[model samples]
Target chain A: MVSIRDVAKAAGVSTATVARVLNGGTPVSPDRTERVLRAVQELDYVSNGVAASLSRGRTGLLGLLVSDIANPFTAQVARGLEDEAVRHGYQVLIASSDFDSEREAQVLASFARRTVDAVALLSSSGVGEGVARLIRNGIPTVFVDRRPPDLGEIPLVRTDSLSAAREAVRYLIDLGHTDLGMISGPAGMPTAAQRLAGFREACATAGLVVRPKCVREGFLGTQGGYTAMCEVLDLPVRPTAVFSFNNVLAIGALEAVRERDVRIPADLSLVTFDDTDLFPFVDPPITAIEQPAYDIGAEAGKLLFARIDGAETAGTDVVLPTRFHVRGSCDRPGR
Target chain B: MVSIRDVAKAAGVSTATVARVLNGGTPVSPDRTERVLRAVQELDYVSNGVAASLSRGRTGLLGLLVSDIANPFTAQVARGLEDEAVRHGYQVLIASSDFDSEREAQVLASFARRTVDAVALLSSSGVGEGVARLIRNGIPTVFVDRRPPDLGEIPLVRTDSLSAAREAVRYLIDLGHTDLGMISGPAGMPTAAQRLAGFREACATAGLVVRPKCVREGFLGTQGGYTAMCEVLDLPVRPTAVFSFNNVLAIGALEAVRERDVRIPADLSLVTFDDTDLFPFVDPPITAIEQPAYDIGAEAGKLLFARIDGAETAGTDVVLPTRFHVRGSCDRPGR
Candidate 1:
């Protein structure tokens, strides 16, 4: 291991000079700085984070909590967060709660114990209680993807799910489809509730009857969508078009329609919320409400740093817009 | 926040007894344990990891290095690793390198500074040069997915890429396809090289000639696969069947064929390496070589713990098998 003393001795300078160069404390002469850097490279010196943290009383780490890592949407959000965090000279410690409230609480406590400079969450469950408790105890927190119930002024980064849902529903309505159904996400999730509300609002504005039989709440994955679609398909008067609240549900609906030999845009029209890089490859290319997931993550990261830098004011909410991607899956009935 | 003294007073036990109950150090009367547990629940006591580390002289945190977090394959591997790690009373610190060697080295140095108990890597770019320094300094490490060039004896958990590729190619061959092309992964990646070797060996065994125009190398992602497929499509003598080295490439090939109006199976047969949860949902349903990614991660985790426990032996390599899933994409040349 190359110590500051070794670098100082190699460069014929004092150890304080080497320390100053490494820590960027005070400027050193260009010649001495070059010598110190050369010695560092040659010796392959790696700083000890534990020792540094002990001296500085900070870990230079940020903690992130997500509902699940297996979900591609959440994974993409994490990717954006990590990119921005690393750029800002911070590392991330990630924890997944699997949408379990107890697990979310445990992860929150763990993050606090690690003394991370700040925390971010993509919480669907009401783990905001734990987060609020942490805030009361003076830990900086920023919520992403899901807005907590009592988020009054707390910094939140999210997509405009309600408006996105309305846009998707309106697109289907424009396609000359009156009989519509929806497969929604889990009931308690704020985003899911907002999307459902948007769907109803769109139906009322268009003078289309919103039937109770058309909606089902469950997991936001393929199986959930499949089961929900089955229910809708079994109705005495089945919907001619379906708006899936998320991509997983849309995928499930596609599979369901295919299994039943229902021709897309001929017998049924479909549109999904959220788009991924892989979505374009699907046959009949899905019409989607594309959320700016990457931008949301970057914005949340910047906000978190702001809070960490003593922006003691109550955090603000940032809702990014979603774009409607018109593709082959959405078209006029009997196309 | 509840203290041990509070729990002790409520349970009518000494503080030492309360501590032992919380740490699960010794057996206590069931009645007393229940009382203490109730008190803990009522008071909402959360254990602090840093404070515990200070008392125990270890943080109980492990570091994980992944090539990319956005890659679904890597994400699945990480999920498996973390699942096993958490079960054994450890949390993971994740860092991604984006396939850059310098970033990988930086993450390695960062993990070491944190004094992580062990480190696991999903796809390491460079050989054990930088990590060898960590090993010399007494840090335990286990490589997953990819291994260093010189660290032959180091602990490694990887899928049998040779067999996986052979099976994927043989599946296409068995489907009555003769002219086949392959989209390979980036150069210098051990898994990619091994997969290519397997493909070549399978062709040689069947007395099939591999055309020079049939192979191209780049990162394993949607764009990489797409670019390679564009190159393959531009060739004067295009293959009747194609085998993509990984799922990302398979996705790219799917898109390319769609763009070119090339009908799958009827016009081109396709098979891919590494099946993910999302693979089956793609249109035409891709056939794939399914590597036991989760098992590999679990095995690597166990290996790391074994080393940490002072197994007193040289590191070992464990290679798991791959299964080929036949789907709708491959067929007889005439379809």
Candidate 2:
């Protein structure tokens, strides 16, 4: 094990100077702080807080890891978790991965070191390594929103994005539209893959064939959605209806369409996943699949508390239902 | 400090067994885990992660505290900070305070214990005790958006909300409006107080008296804004124009007016602080005072990195400028 003395020697500083830097904020010279940091990295010193905290037990804190805390979807779910935790006296520490796997691993390791009671994760790039550590450490963990396709034997509480997306496509087909364009999420993410799969399955069941050009994958961001929409629009014999995977994507797609002088649901009906306040207020009032982010958080909290209470439990996969918010944005083709 | 041995003795476990539990996941029995947790709580043991981390140096991490990460205003700023820090290879750990001062204190303490590089705060309920502790401990701390009105010697980077709000009100007044109503945020928050003061100052300068009934204080939440808007609407001789303090409030207030079947700008001119995508997409795109949330975060990150690089600096109050986004929502009021 790397010790304070070793780090001190490597950094060419006194053990106390190293401690001052490590303890955070005691006005150590920047040069000494830099040297100590380098030494710690070289030594690969594991944090002792988790070990120390385990002696104290259940920090009454739950660590939440997601790609972007600023993402409205993530934020809403967090709000639900934060509000519910108050009932059982748990505070949440949320960190953003910014879609980087390495960052996620570092944060997960930090959470474990903090000895949080549990973890609620919305996996960015398959939090595989971090999940492995959490499980090995016996810290209860639950996946939220997006997780790996399968966790072998781990608890997950998330919206059924695939089923909801399928239902959305079916609704559009029933409204008498065959030619449909889809704005898909990035390929690697399970949410994106599932939604695309559902869209294909729905088209297959309806005996309708979608042109390859009509299905475009994007970074699942605003600009990605807009560019994809433009591509779909330029396609010869463009689809009369479009299915955007989520709210942000829908917003961008809608903007692209708005720039063109097209009447919504008359020229092109639009539907997307993820409902938010802005959806209903948009000029045409977009129809969307509500992910029920709050409910997912509430359920994740429930599962976590059960584990913290030492419940002899199975690794349950709690799949919550989604609802389609019908609005003026979708209608019979050429309405 | 309460040692692991003490915890083990209290839990009727051996020192090695206690070590196994603290080190995490080597699999102690559920009964033993329960007993250990109880013992730890009774002993009030804090983990030694900070000591371990300090022995190492610069965690390559920064801590950010905000009232609500879900709040669009807060989230956008976080996005900027997160985006900027990646340039310097620093990751951010953002904790939602949920607008509670107590939670802010606890999170701050944990950050210090974990030995993060520095902290950026978007205060809720004035980061009183926590700021004191951070300063006393020599942690480089900077304030973003909202801080205590008087911190004497702390760096603060925020949008100039007061001047912006005042300018917005003056614009409305100049647009042929004698009477006006306002949906103000809770008075306790410095942001709220500043905006309110700006409005009052503007009214005084215009030689206009604010009717007490036209002013309402909301929780700065959707429902609160809705209720306040309704009250203002029902007042006898209602003001022709309304100024909402921020985006969320504007959303709720807009819904209230939408239900009333009144023509915007003509029946009731509306202006607000905080421009969002929804504002421009709505019917009669909103007139808004755009607070530069991202710029504020970017500047905060810059100030923090400077402090981390060992710049001997005095407390800086960096106030960024706001822009008025004029849209069709405001017109010469009539009918």
Candidate 3:
């Protein structure tokens, strides 16, 4: 329990000078600063973060909530946010919601209780009540990759999923694939809903009927994709091309295809969303809609910090464009 | 700013009852608990974590340091730790060391300043001084994946990388491949040292010559792997088979091989360490030594919690076994 007084005594400096040096406040002479640091180190005097936070009314902590930390896309976003937070001299407290709205709400409540300086959400479930709670607590928040409806003005950084999905589907249609299939994410998630809408728009524009049997809802996991892909394969009139709206789902669908000995592109052209590093190593690689996951996170982090610093950043919606990477996964339909 | 008194009055309960409910202390009646929760929600009451932590001397926060969070193996470990922490009513604050000892030290100091209940380290760099600081501060710690020597029995939960590497190399030898190349991590890292030792032991047992020109060092990254593999390939007498002691390095080596139009398992056999989800999808589906990353994390988390709960777990070293998954990445070296 060594205190600032002990550090000051060891350094032969005043308590005020020690506080200034430790808190990164007004600068002290270089020689004094060196002495203070060395003495603090030798005495092992750790400033009580709790006490400092209580007095300053700031925790120097940022809260980040993600649906799944194990997901590569989510992990990249977290990495970006963490890097940015470190640059701003803040540490991030991360909690996973596991795609459950209740869990998300509980985590948000915990963040509120912790009095985190700001919060960022990549929630896959409904965040209406949880966000309202944050706002009620006067906590600055930013949305990443998911947007809540009617939330007045919370800054958000997200990918243009609709346009990306539309372009991917149109590519398949251009390759003379009149019948198309899709493995969509959970219906309620905003990203999923947008991708699904994009799929419909692409089919309608091409004068192609999107068979209900060909469209299956996936749980944004590999198993969900496997099940949905199997159902699509079992259809009476199978689709010539299929789109899996997420990388994990695409992986599962690929497994399903490989298990059934269905050759990619040759037998059924495939397209996927959210290109990750592993895409290139996969057999035949994958043609994917690449979302700027890192950028989205970095932007959200910047926006949250701006709000925390008392900037009027309400209603700032930053939508980054996606890239269409044409790889070895898709080709024209064959006999 | 909503005080306990206000919530107690609104719920028609005593302030003690409100505090008990909010702090998850002695349980009150279910009816009263329900009323207190409703009143809390209606009034948007948030307990001050900093003030409560100051009084209680526990922050309910666990600190985790990893080399890289974006790596899938690291992410899985983090996910396991987070899940275990959540089950025990604690949250995790994760920081990446990025393989720099200075950064690792800084993060540990911050964790101490914040008074985290416990810490888990997956540090790639020398953590001697950082760990000493933690010990001096009386903070419970568990080592995951990497262990620092002469630490006087700090609990460590890690994979048996040495034996796993030996087995993987043995499999390559049994396939009649004598000349073998390796892409090893930085020399000082414990995991890399152990893996390199295992490779040598296997080669020695097989009466194979260990060529200095064939063994290249990598930085635990894809680019590092690529550079090392290129050097190996440029050798006057290239080895028939190669072992990458890490997954990212193997990815880089694979890329280099692909660029040269050299077919895997035909022109050159390959084996890798750390089997992740993406391994199965990779071209040729790499044969790998699968470390139980998630289990290591979960076990370390359990050990850390036990230490935090005042259990006598000093010097407990838990070494989880690794599994060798034989995939399509390896075969007898052929003309």
The model with the greatest TM-score is 3
Q: Give the alpha carbon lDDT tens digit for every residue of B143-223 in model 2.
A: 897778668578888788788888989988899888988999988888888888898888899998999999999885788
lDDT of 3 at B285: 89
Q: Which residue pairs come into collision in candidate 2?
A: A22-B54, A49-B49, A137-B25
* Highest DockQ model number: 3
* Candidate 3, residue B159: lDDT: 84
- Show where candidate 2 strays beyond 4 Å: A1-61, A84-90, A105-117, A127-130, A133-139, A312-314, B1-51, B57-61, B84-90, B101-117
Sort by DockQ, best first: what order? 3, 1, 2
Q: Rank the candidates by TM-score, best first.
A: 3, 1, 2
- List the candidate 3 regions with Cα displacement exceeding 4 Å: A5-17, A24-42, B5-17, B24-42
- For all predicted structures, in order, the TM-scores are 0.88, 0.80, 0.95
Give the TM-score of chain A in candidate 1.
0.87
The list of candidate 1 runs beyond 4 A from truth reads A1-47, B1-48, B51-55
DockQ of 1: 0.44
- Which of 2 and 3 is ahead in lDDT? 3
Candidate 3 structure quality by residue, lDDT tens digits, A133-205: 7888888988899777777488889988888899899999998999999999999888899999999999999
lDDT of each candidate versus the true structure? 0.78, 0.80, 0.87
Interface RMSD in Å per candidate, to 1 decimal? 3.2, 7.1, 1.4
Clash pairs detected, candidate 1: none
